[model samples]
Target: MFWQWLTAPWQYEFMVRAILLSVVVGLVCGALSCYMVLRGWALMGDAISHAVLPGVILAHVLNLPLALGAFVFGVGSVLTIGFVESQTRIKEDTVIGIVFTGFFALGLVLLSKVKSTIDLTHILFGNVLGISNTDIYQTVISSVVTLTILFLRQRDFLLFCFDPTHARSIGINTNLFHYLLLSLLSLTAVAGLQAVGIILVVAMLITPGATAYLLTDRFDRMLGLAMGLGAAAAIVGNYVSFYLDVATGGCIVLVQTLLFGLAVFFAPKHGILARKFWAKIDL
Candidate 1:
């Protein structure tokens, strides 16, 4: 009965597509999540995810690809935040807050005014089961490009995230990598829009890496663990959503959160239980 239950969702074509795309989004987001965590850019991920709203609306109005608009707005918000922070006494976080909220508000206004078939609720919360072929293509292409770049520049990115001052002293173009990471983040967020939508996409981009962080100190291991956890959560969450009739994206993120919670108490070196055990032994 358990095996049959597991196999039932796969019989539907939509389930297959949802699982595939969710896994792809999970892997890419997981990989990028490492960099974001190491670099202390969690809020940036949230910023970009929210900021892409206006671009998506514009894309629909212009009859262009939503991913393109999302990327542009995502990148644009980053650049805007950088520029504003540099020119004023404002901190980056404040600038990011202002920019993303403003863009998000603009997007809401556009959504209200635009006479189109775009479902605002779906855009915010996601509709992975209803994903179209075109969305699948866009998501796959974006994931491929984001993952390829991340893999090729893995070492450099690690150095930059770990110690930017040292990376700059060693002659790495920190500026170039700064924008590169942001761009890739934007693209990844765009790819994830179809799976988890904008509001929850930041969780997909963050939780896996965070969960892995508790499990290992090594960045490479963290990366692998995060990706594995993310993909597993995607598959399991999708199945749960199918049987329970819940929101797929929410289920996926909740699964990730559950893993993170487990790691918090059970991880070997960093977890609460481990520390407690070691402390008792010392006593």
Candidate 2:
């Protein structure tokens, strides 16, 4: 039975597409997340993921490509957050709260308007059971763009993340780089949203990076570790989805969560377990 399905899985283009999309999104987000964690923007990633939903629905309503709408709304939301924070004397967290809630509410309203005609469930939760070749191509393109952004700005991003004061002193366009990084993050989130849904999509963006932090302190090491963990989760989640009939994206997130838990318990100096042991031995 296993052999039969394995032999025939690619006979269905949708299955192939689903697998391809999952891997591409995972890889792209994993790489981008290294910068996110160091910049203290993990929660921002979560917010950005949720922010893209309205754009997606608006596009769906207008019969446009979801990615196009997602990028527009996603970038718009990031700017709005900046505008709100600067215009009001509010804390950044408060601004983030306002932006995600307001934008997500807008998405829900838009989805409700077309809920009868469209399978809105797939929009929120994703219908990754099948995908199109177009989606596969788009995913690959997005992955490349994400990588290119990271490569072109790696030094600036790293300096901003590790020591923004020094980065600014060195004449980096710290503010421009900051906003541009957030914009890139939103773009990555939008790319993954259509494939993985918001919850898992955001979770993947944050989780692998968090896990990598637990495993390593060096920037490049963390990036490598995050990518490896993400790819591993995708493979395991795919198997779990295929054999156990679970949600693929959620299952992948679950794998990340478990890995994170383990990292917390058993990783090096920063790990809870390791820190405790060191204190006890010294005492």
Candidate 3:
């Protein structure tokens, strides 16, 4: 009975596809999340994820690929925010809030008009189990492109994220890297849409990286650990969801959140209780 329960979810093709897609999305989001964490761009991820909604709707209505529409709007949102921040005294976060909310609201209006063809629930919350072959292929492509860029540009991007002035002094084009990272962010969010939807994508993009940051100081190790945590969460979350009949994306995010909570109290150097314990020992 134990063995059967463990192997049960793989008996169907849908489960296999769902699990594969989830793993890919988890890995890609986790890797990029390290940079997002370091750069204080958590809100940016949320902004892009929500801002893609209208693009997805527009794509469906125009019979274009969903990813294409999502990518366009995601980039558009970033550009708009940048333009706003550059032209005024407003803060980046404030600009992001205003822009994303407007795009998401527009998406909602577009969604209402096309309710018959598009499912708002699925777009907002995702349907991993209902993933199609086309989605799998697109996810695979997105993962490849995202991972490749991250690997090749890791050092340069890290410099930019940590200290943009230093990166500029070192002859790196801060503007170029900034936009490049945003492009990757947009792609990853679009890819993640199939597994976790817009709402949970922010969690996926932030939680794993935050958890890994608490546990490690080394950036490479942080990336590896975050990816592992995310992939494990997705797999376990899917299995638990299958048995309990709950929402897959929510379950996955729940597991990531739990892991983060654990890190908060137990991580060696950064955790709250760990610091207290170390101080006591020092005394």
TM-score of each: 0.97, 0.90, 0.97
Candidate 2: tens digits of C-alpha lDDT, residues 1-283: 8788665555666666676677777787888878777778877888888888888778767877667777787778888998989998999998988898788899888888878866766766666776556656666776788788888888888888888899878777788888778767777886667566776678778888988988986888888888888778876677677768888767777888899999999998888989999999999
**Which pairs of residues collide in model 3?**
none
TM-score of 3: 0.97
Local accuracy of candidate 3 as per-residue lDDT tens digits, 1-283: 9999999999988888888889999999999989999999999999999999999899889987777898899999999998999999999889999999999999999999999988888888988999777778877898899999999999999999988999999788999999989989988898888788888999999999999999999999999999998899999899989999999999999999999999999998999999999999999
Tens-digit per-residue lDDT, 1-283, candidate 1 = 9899889999999999999999999999999999988888999999999999999889988988887998899999988998999999999889999999999999999999884678898889899999989889988998999999999999999998888999999899999999999989988887778788889999999999999999999989999999998899999999989989999989999999999999999999999999999999999
lDDT of each: 0.92, 0.79, 0.92
**What is the overall TM-score of model 2 with all chains considered together?**
0.90
Predicted structure 2: lDDT: 0.79
Give the runs in model 2 whose Cα sits over 4 Å from its true position.
1-13
**What local lDDT score does residue 170 receive in model 1, on the 0 to 100 scale?**
89
Stretches of candidate 3 off by over 4 Å are: none
lDDT of 1 at 198: 89
Better of 2 and 3 by TM-score: 3
In model 1, the runs with Cα more than 4 Å from the true position are none
